[model samples]
Target: MKITFLGTGTSLGIPIIGSKHPVCLSKNSKDKRLRSSILIEKDQKNFLIDCGPDFRYQMLRSNHERLNAIFITHEHQDHIGGLDDVRPINFNMNQPIPIYGLRRVIENLKKRFFYIFSKNKKSNVSKISVYELDDYKNFFIVENYKIFPLLTWHGQLPILGFRIENFAYITDASHIPFQTIQRLKGINILVLNILRKEMKHSFPFMLSETLKITQQICPQKTYLTHISHTFGFHEEIEKQLPKDVYLAYDKLIIYE
Candidate 1:
């Protein structure tokens, strides 16, 4: 299986508009992050996770040709803003793309993109099918691969993280429950969100806190995503991280 880090920055993204921080001012391409999202491909099937605000740009950058499904982590605007862009693929394929997510997420999508779900509203048609998944449910299986959802805390709100094959990607998480940890143990690759170096935000997991979780999960390789500009330059932060842990940058690809 192959995984691509489409975007690794948080909701505000790096270079936060008018900020004068040094990391944001850097000219390096890796420092210019979009938003948090990923692409997973195996066999002939291609799937997307969290089609955020930068979705169109990401697709163009990667020259993506196919999209079979989209799995959402939450209902946050930054996570689902680019959802309607899937319409192009649907039009080309002449079929509705299947989207899987928690019930609240599906409801939010319906409300936010009501026009797409409406049969009478045809201004800009969006051909897509929705599959509402329950927390901790086994969903959308491929041969030899099944996705397991783990309910996690993103501050006070419940969020979801997924494990597929030997790879697990979790983001926007604050605290992972003990029960969820039981399921996440012994994964080959683990990706989790680690925000600022200092913990002051409403979000749950800070840098050190996330690392402790990673140590317990003990994946062969751990990647930290959903980064903020406060994390410092990509090269500088990378030098300080443990050998097995990596700060995921946009467009980075991993195979397992």
Candidate 2:
């Protein structure tokens, strides 16, 4: 399996509008993050997680040719804003993209992108099929990839994090339930969201809280994503974290 960090910044992304923060102004390309999103590839099939607002640009930059499915964590605008851009892929690939998420998320997509869900809509529009998911469900999405859903809390919203093979990816999660923590044990790689040094947002984790959780989970490697400019320079933050933890940047790819 191969995991690609398509984008690792928060809702506003790094280098927020009109801000002259040093991290924002840095010339390092890694510092210039888009919104948080990721792609998982197993065999020849591709599964995208959280098609955020920067989805189009990220796809173009990565030269993505096709997407087999989309897994949503929640219904936040930043995550779903780029849903419409999947049109070209659908047209070119000549197939409907399977979308998996919670029931509420499916409902939100139907209402938000009414044209796609319209019963008598034109055929040219992208075809998207929805599959509602539940926490703790373990099932095969593709021939070789079996996924387990881990239910977590992002403030009031119920976010569905995923465990694929040896990797666990969770974002926009504020608190993971005790049962989910049990499922996350023995992960080779774990990715969690840490918006800023502190907990100012309804979603995302406080740095200290995340560190404590990591210590307990004890994954082989733990990388933090969904970061904001407030998290400070990547190199500086890297100095503070333990050797096993890392700050993920856009375009980082991992394979096992």
Candidate 3:
């Protein structure tokens, strides 16, 4: 299996338009981030997680042949805004891409992308197929992968994380339900969101809070994502993390 970090920044992304933060002013490529997302490649098939506003750029950088499916974490705009960009791929493949997400999230996608589902509407002729998933009821399986959806909390809003084989990816989780924790046992490579160094917000898990959760999960290696400028420069933050934990940067790749 191969995993690629498409974009590792927070909702607003690292440079946040015109802010004068030092981290934002840095010229280092690692300091430059787009939005949070990833691409998983296995058996020549590509699976995407969170098609944020930077989806087009991400795809150009990914260089993958085609997409098999997209797994959404929630309905936040930063997570789904660039969904329309999939049309080109649709035209090339001559089929609608399958989108898997929670029932509530899928419904919200309809409202946000209403034109796509409407007939006789003047808009891009994009096509999509949605699959409403019950993460609590059963594990999802597709092609050569068996995916286990783990329920996580983004503040009070319930969200999902996925476990495939020995690798698990969980982003924007403020808390992990006990049942979900039970499912994560023995995961080798784990990805979790750690917003910044400070434990200021209850919505996004900060560095310390995320570390606590990492200790509990005890994966062989943990890569932190969904970073903010407040987290400091990528070069500096990379050194502070505990052994086996890493700060993921855009375009970073992992093989398993």
Candidate 4:
């Protein structure tokens, strides 16, 4: 299986608009990140996790030709903002893309993108089929591939993480249930989120919190995403992490 870090920054992304923060001003490409998202490939099937506002550019840069399905972690605008940008793929595939999310998230999308959901939509509009995921039920994207949805929390909002084979992808998660951690024990490769070195909000994990959880989950390797400028320069801060931990940057790819 292969995984691509399409984008690795937090909601506002790195180099937030109108800011002169040094990390944002840095010339290193690693310091310049788009909103957090990833693309996963297993066998010949492709799956996208979190299509943020930067989705179009991410896909173009990576030159990924096809996506079999989309999985949403939550209903936040940063994660779902690029839902409309799937039109080109829809046109190329000549079919509706399948997207999986929680019931509330599905409802949110229908309201936010009412035009796309409208019964009499234009022929040129993007097309997608929505699937509601039950927090307690595992589902399959295909006959051979099973996707296990691991429930997590973003403050008070319930969100989801996923386990496919020995690999897992999770982001924008604050509190992870004990059952979820039990399920994730000994994962091979984990893509988890860490907003910054310290926590200023209750909705996401900080470096310390994520690291503690990492130890608990015992993944062979952990790639941290959903970063912010305050997390420090990529090259320097990354060097400080444990041997198996890494700060994932935009466009980075890995295999498991």
Instruction: For each candidate, give its TM-score against the true structure.
Output: 0.96, 0.95, 0.97, 0.97
Position 115, candidate 1: lDDT: 91
Candidate 3 per-residue C-alpha lDDT over 1-256 given as tens digits, one digit per residue, 9 for 90 to 100: 9999999998889798899999999999999898999999988888899899999999998876478899999999889998989998898788989999999999999998899888777867668899999757588877758888889999889998888899999998989988888888899999999888985997889898889888998999999999999999999999999999999999999976
Candidates' C-alpha lDDT? 0.87, 0.87, 0.90, 0.91
Candidate 1: clashing pairs of residues: none
User: How does candidate 2 fare on TM-score?
Assistant: 0.95
Error of 2 at 137 (Å): 4.3
Candidate 1 residue spans exceeding 4 A from truth: 137-144
- Window of ten residues with lowest summed lDDT in model 4: 135-144
Predicted structure 2: clash tally: 0
Is candidate 1 or 4 superior in TM-score?
Answer: 4
Summing lDDT over every window of 10 consecutive residues in candidate 3, give the lowest-scoring window: 135-144
Q: Candidate 2, residues 1-256: lDDT per residue as tens digits? A: 8889999998899889999999989888878889999998888888899988899998999889699889899899888889888988897799888989998999999999899999898766768889988645565465457878889998987888888877999998889898889888999999998978964666678798789888888899998999889888898888899888999999999885
